[model samples]
Target: MAARVWRDPVLWLAFGFGSGLAPVAPGTFGTLPGVVLAALLGLLAPAIGVPLWAVVLLALIVLTPIGIGLCGAASRRLGVHDHGGIVFDEIVGVLIPFLLVPVTPWTLLLAFLWFRLFDVVKPWPIRWLDRHVSGGWGIMVDDLLAGVFALAAVGLSVHFWPG
Candidate 1:
């Protein structure tokens, strides 16, 4: 059966433009929309008045909850918990590493790699949250931590990378 997102526009956004519908590696694909969004915001920041960092920060703050709600609702409708195809959480998580960071291809690629690593590994408190938290929060929290981990890694890279 096709995903509800195919029939519903709202679900389409929540599911990260059907990236989450991929049979393999949905999480990775799902994160792509956030990457594109960050890149566009960064590219447009100069023309748009707001700084790239501000745009990234605002997006994470505003959209995180909405992603949570959407993921939770989708999970409920599907009768499953944290389904792979419900990856709005991945999109939200990917945004964190780019907050206040340059959105160049190099930086974005590094951040994406780190986000995926931390997301898949689920280290320490991230793993704890994954185990204890439930519902949409459950789906979102670990990825949020992964983004933070990636943020730190990306920060270090930015600092150390020489001209």
Candidate 2:
């Protein structure tokens, strides 16, 4: 028989399958892969990177329900609540940083760091939303809010620091 693909938990974890279940910081690790993916995506389309990011956002929106459902079901199977491995939240979170930003290496790095920081810190409404919310939407909402905050930070920093 052919070797099965995606059979390893490490493989799944590396792909953010368990990022959602991360005990202390699910979103933090969960979003890292997205940052890496966005950086790669940025490199492929530096000129229209922001538009490409929009495409990613659209794709994420379409996939959210499916992702949430899968993650929720998986959580039930695993006997866990929001398993850290379910990292669609991270994928969604990282896309925000590239929405309007130029796709230079520096910008990509900045976006990654900004998104990670915001995701981990979970300030203001992100924290509020995270606490109040539940279920699959809840799993992704906090990271989405964190992404918004990160995008704002990057925007302001770009506006003022323009270097």
Candidate 3:
């Protein structure tokens, strides 16, 4: 069956667009689209790419409400809330670890592990923000915090690891 644009943008967003429609684990599927996106973006140059990556995060933070609004409107049009199809949060969250880290296999592996840990754990202010914030921003903030934790660990590992 053909997909309706009214439901999603493109499949590259991953099943996140469709996953949003899923009855369960929409967040998990929504996050996968982001993982792939990070790997692809990691291929870019650190000079331009790092800043660009940060900009993407800024844009995501800035644009989240817009996205949520769109989602909300879509939900109203379709009748739902917190649709699984929206995965921009994952994209932004995943980008945090990759922003400055070297895109090596080992580094990528470590970053991936760390990011997932923080995301799932949701420590400190991340947990607070996740609980207090409402709407799309709330959905996205926790992951961004997770990325921060991952980035810190990756940075420290790079700084402290012995040759």
Candidate 4:
């Protein structure tokens, strides 16, 4: 099973390119790819004559559905519901807060921390959705909501603090 998972392309993606395979803090490790992705998008924006926020948003739009499918399929393949090893959701989740926001080392760190907090803490509706929803949507929605929560928090912080 482990060998099969490692060999499968879909599983490879669902595992956040193996970051999700970490012995501890899989989600944190999974989120690192998102950080790298966000940074790459940020760098690409200027060269493409696009805004950073736009580039990130476009990526999220593209990746969210793919993450959902990859997560769902991987979960089915593993015969587990939202397996911890499937971190595509985490990859997608971390991108939400960075959307429409300035990308800086500080902001990226804050987004990562905030997204992780909301994801792990699973507040209110996020928790509710996580428990009730099923399949790919089930696996993906909670983290998306967590990302929204983090986005709000990050937005507020940036607004009042204005660093």
RMSD of each: 1.6, 4.7, 4.6, 1.4
Candidate 1 lDDT by residue in tens digits, 40-152: 87788878888877888888889888878887787777788888887788888888877758788988888888889888888999989988998988888889989999999
RMSD of 1: 1.6
Candidates' lDDT values, in order? 0.82, 0.67, 0.60, 0.87
Clashes of each: 0, 13, 3, 0
List of clashing residue pairs for candidate 3: 17-85, 20-84, 20-85
lDDT of candidate 2 over 90-145, digit per residue (tens): 77677776777766666666777888888777788888887887776777788777
Ranking by lDDT: 4, 1, 2, 3
Query: 1-163 in candidate 3: lDDT tens per residue?
Result: 1155334554323235565444565555566666666666555545454554565566556655655555445544434333455555655666677666755666666666677677667899888987797565566677678878888988787678621
RMSD from true fold, candidate 3:
4.6
Candidate 4, residue 67: how far the Cα is off, in Å: 1.2
Among all windows of 10 consecutive residues in model 1, the one with the lowest summed lDDT is 1-10
The residue-level lDDT of candidate 4 at 145 comes to 92
Best candidate (score: lDDT): 4
- Lowest-scoring 10 consecutive residues by lDDT in candidate 2? 1-10
Root-mean-square deviation of candidate 4: 1.4
Off by over 4 Å in 1: none
